[model samples]
Target: MADSFSQAARAATNELRQLFEPTPLQRNDHLSAQYGAEIWLKREDLTPVRSYKLRGAFTAMAAVLAQRSDQKVFVCASAGNHAQGVAFACRHFGVTGVIFMPVTTPEQKIAKTRIFGGDNIEIRLVGDYFDDTLAASQGYCAEAGGHFLAPFDDADVILGQASVGVEILDQLGKEPDIVILPVGGGGLSAGLTRLFRETGAASSFRYVEPFGGASLTAALAHGAPETLESVDSFVDGAAVARIGALPFETLKNVAMEHVILSKEDSLCATMIDMLNVEGIVLEPAGALAINALEQIKDQVKGKTVICVTSGGNFDFERLPEVKERAQRFLGRKKYFILRLPQRPGALRDFLGLLGPHDDIARFEYLKKSARNFGSVLIGIETTSPDAFEALFSRLDNAGFVYRDITNDDTVAQFII
Candidate 1:
């Protein structure tokens, strides 16, 4: 069964070649050397839509249109890379599309989706959140009698996403010892896993999810789809509250030990690493697979491992925040609430104790506590991690009362 499924996927991928060239299977020297393993990236980030979402959209749409020629209208709701994939695929198929996005989506993404679809699609700015936006799109789809394309959850969509796996096998000329995949709504991972199993490749598998949104891992543990109480939306691409039903059905049997949770800040560090070292821009979700390597280093060393850097639809406006997160993760930067003497020479004395490389980035007087002291919030950036240690030690020696707020989510969200 696995061999036949793999064979069918190959045929599908071959047919897809007419649509676009194969995404690269580039061996990354920096990552390989860092991990002491043959680390190859499937480079799904280089696809036409800068994501693997396009492969599934194209395959599913083609199969559907071939059967129902009159199904000319398609609808989908997405606030990120998936919308662009559907828009691009809509234009490719010459079908009319309605894309609904949350009002909170950045103008840059909105513009890019419009540019990709051109005259073949319409953009709808719906609710403030994704769930509401999706509800609106579903209503519109029912009223207009169009097919609602799920980003994941559908078997056909999963089969369509399987094209990535098919291409990976073809491009590499051999099977990898392990494959690390990033999980979002689960379409890509489900499709790839099914195809690999069908191909008789029990390649060791590792699944990465954002620390704030480990839906796939959660589902596998519970042996069912489970909704998270709350999800952090930092890695917007993979910030799903729940795994897709069909996806969980296929993935639930995988061992919990193989699923890894990537902290958002740590993912930022990898994003910075890829951009600086490889000149490759990756969205947070795209960095998940690579970030998992540090945790699995001992197991992957000297093995042929492939990490699927999922998507590159990164918005530059978020670059500053990414950098800040990276710095925090690396421990070279910090924020704090400091209690200092209000006397004129007190501020000067505090400044004099700082290391030469320590620079104050932000300093705001929060409140006046007493006649002799004031509360201040300060953010510090340093050239080296040890600079912070030196600066903090000096502050302690000087008897300055301070609370480190760098990782304080509640305060950082409002002030940082």
Candidate 2:
């Protein structure tokens, strides 16, 4: 089975050359130095569609076309990389493709998908959420008799994603000591796991998932795939509520300890660092594996590690939010509610308590809680994380009442 799978992967990879060359597997010096390990990145972000989704989309579409040469239409629902992948594949195959995306999807993504598909694909703005868009697309496919292309669930899609593992082994010329992969719906991780196991590679694996969308972790816990009650969509590319059934079949044996749940905000710091330091732009999902290194640096030190930076379809519009989240995660920024006296100089007194390096980023006055007191939302930015301690001490010494709501998600959602 291993040999056969390897052969199939090689074949798919060879066919993929018709679309684009193999994504780079470059050794990263900065990351290597930072982690005290030899760190290499499989640059899937450099793909034509800026993601690995194209590999699976093209392979799955090719397989369908091979079986049904008369097939004229393909259908998929995606707001991001998958939509772009399918659109590109449709144009290459000269087939009519219907790409369904949520109505709330960013115009940038929608426009990019349209540009990829050209005249061969039609963009359908359907539901407000992905689930609704998915259901609508399936119904449209069934009604139109068009082939439905799943993002990660199908066997062919898994086979296509396995090609990444093939490329990794071939490019590295030797097995890595460790491979850290970002997990979304499990297709990429499952495919690579199967390929490595089949090839008998000695490398161990660590799977990284966004903390809010930890379907793989949940699956490992429940002994089967389970839908998350709620998923944070910040890591939009990898925020899958449920792991794919087909992929889970291949990944069911993975140990719970091998999985790492990365905080969503921490990923912003990784993204910002890669962009500013390495000049690499990455989406939140793409930063998962790299961000996870901080959690396992002790174990990976002195070893050859490969981290797959998954996608780079980032919208610059979100840069401010990313910076904010990154600062919050690093403790360089904070938000708090202060109970201030309504009397004169109260604001001045509060401002005077701040450290010299502290800068107010936001100061909004909420309604008055009493005749002499009022609630003020304040956001502070500082040069160092430790500055907050001194500032808090000063606030305490001044007999000021305050609530640190920086990490309070409920209050943050409402105010921050």
Candidate 3:
């Protein structure tokens, strides 16, 4: 079954060539040297939709339409890349599509998705959250007798996503020693793994997922799909609460040790690194596989490896937040709640403890607690991480009682 699916994927790849040439398989010198490995990035970010989702959407829609000629209307719920993929595919096939997105999805993303679909698709902003939107889409599909598309769970979608593996092997002329895949809904990983196994490719595999949404690893541990209680939406593309059933079936035998978890903040650091150092603009989800490589650097040394850069639907408006998260994760920034005396020279005295490298990024007085003291929220950024040690020492010596709120999730989330 896997071999037949992979063969169909290969044929789909050939058909896709007519729509868009294969995305680049380029050697990344910076990443390669940093990891001591010959790291090649399968630049799925270079795709027409700037993601591998398009392949799956196109393949599934085409296959479905071929068998069921009367099924022209397609419905899907996605606020990000998947919506764009379906939209683009609808335009390609001259079919009508209805996309349901959470009302809170970024305007930039909705605009891009609309542009891709043009007149072939309709964008509907439904519920404020993804779950609500998905339920609404499914309900609409059932009521209208329209075909509903599951982003990653359907076999045809997986077969479509397998085309990425086919292109990678063809472009490389052989399989690499390792293939790193980013896990979201698990369509891409399932598709690629099936492709590798069916083709008799000997490449080892590593799966990376956001720490807040380690659905794949959790599913692997439980031997079935398990929905997370909560998931951080920072890495929006990969923030799935539950792994799809079909995807889990393909990836069930994967060793738990091979699944890597990357922190959302740390992923921000990699995003900044790739953008500033390599001139590569990647979304948070796109950086997961590359960021995980840091943890296994020693193991991959002198080996040829491929990292799948999942998507590039990043918005520049989030750049400041990304930089802040990166700096905080690297310990170059700190947020604190300080109680200072309410005196004329109190502010000056508190400022004296800060080193020359420390810059005040944010300041807010929480409340005037007593006649002599006030609770203040302060955010400080520094040139080097060592600057924090000296600053903290000075604050201690000055007899100021302060709480580091950087990692305090409750306080940070509510106040920061």
Per lDDT, the best of the predicted structures is 2
C-alpha RMSD (angstroms) for model 3: 1.5
CA deviation > 4 Å runs, candidate 2: 1-3, 368-370
Task: Compose the digit string of candidate 1's lDDT tens values, residues 183-288.
Answer: 9889988989988887788698899999999999778878898999999999998999999999987898989999999999999999999999999999999999
Question: Which 10 successive residues of model 2 have the least lDDT summed?
Answer: 1-10
The C-alpha stretches of model 1 lying farther than 4 A from their native spots are: 1-3
Q: Tally clashing residue pairs in candidate 3.
A: 0
Residue 155, candidate 1: alpha-carbon lDDT? 73
Per-model lDDT: 0.90, 0.94, 0.93
Per-residue lDDT of 85 in model 2: 94
Tens digit per residue, CA lDDT, model 2, 303-403: 99999999999999999999999999999999999999999999999888888889999999887667989999999999999999999999999999999
Candidate closer to the true structure by TM-score (higher is better), 1 or 2: 2
Candidate 2 to truth, TM: 0.98
Clashing pairs in 2: none
After TM-score superposition, what is the CA distance of residue 196 in candidate 3 from its true location, in Å? 0.7
